[model samples]
Target chain A: MKATVHVTLKPGVLDPQGQTIQRASEAIGFARIADVRQGKFFEVELSDDGDLEAARAELERFARDVLANPVIEDYRVEFLSDLPAASEQE
Target chain B: MKATVHVTLKPGVLDPQGQTIQRASEAIGFARIADVRQGKFFEVELSDDGDLEAARAELERFARDVLANPVIEDYRVEFLSDLPAASEQE
Candidate 1:
């Protein structure tokens, strides 16, 4: 099974890389863009032994402890097969 | 309006950061994990004047030209409000 973790800067946190991208976008003529926040995404492939509940829990723990910095970022985990349609959730 | 860009390394690209994370996961006792690939996610906020089609096209261009390194990475752009549910797509 596969899982994806999204780690994003907490709202109000300063992000220099995001700022750089925002500026670059403006420079490239995308003046309508207002802001940009950058984050990390991790795709993990795990050996699925059919215990999905346990796998989901482990993946969430991995996301919280290993993939995200709590002081500045927030993260969410989703099983690849469980991901919703592209028009429902962020 | 808000959009997200996910930039990931192409398959077969050497990812030292991913290796480090995989090793760290093993050290933390997640032995079932087989591999991990790390990527970047960007959340962009734009001034929406009700033209979503043009906005999406511009966002895609920004993702391709500014947010991703095409030589080594692949990227996808999704409008936050248009993102699918957690189980439909990855």
Candidate 2:
């Protein structure tokens, strides 16, 4: 089984990397962009034994403890299969 | 309007950061983890003028040209509202 974790800065936190990206975007002629916030993504492949509930719990623990800094960031975990492909635009 | 860009390494690329994360996970007792891949996530906020299609097109350009390195990485852009909250787990 595969899962993904998204770690993002808390809303009030400052993001210098994101500011750099925003400036780069403007420099590249994308003037409409107002802001950019950056974060971390992790894709984990797990040894599947069909116990999805256990996998979910383990993933949550991993996300909360290792993948994200709780004081400055918020994280969310999901099964990879649950996400729609990038090609599927709305 | 808000959109997110997910930037990830191509399958054959060397990901030392991911390896380090994997090692860390192992060190922390996550024995079930088989592999870990790391990537970048960007949340972009755009000035809304009520044109969704145009925003999508602009975001695609920004993602392709500025947010990601096409040679070693792959990227996807999505409207933030379209993503289900992380709490909506399966």
lDDT of each: 0.85, 0.85
lDDT, residue A36, candidate 2: 97
lDDT of 1 by residue, A39-61 (tens): 99999998877667767778888
Candidate 2 per-residue lDDT over residues A41-78, each given as its tens digit? 99999877666666667888999998999999999998
lDDT of 1 by residue, B1-90 (tens): 888899999999999999999998899899777789999999999887766666777888888888889999999988778633422433
Going through the candidates in order, their DockQ values are: 0.71, 0.65
Off by over 4 Å in 2: A81-90, B81-90
Q: Which regions in candidate 1 have their CA more than 4 angstroms from the true location?
A: A82-90, B82-90
Query: How many clashes in each structure?
Result: 19, 0
Tell the DockQ for candidate 1.
Answer: 0.71
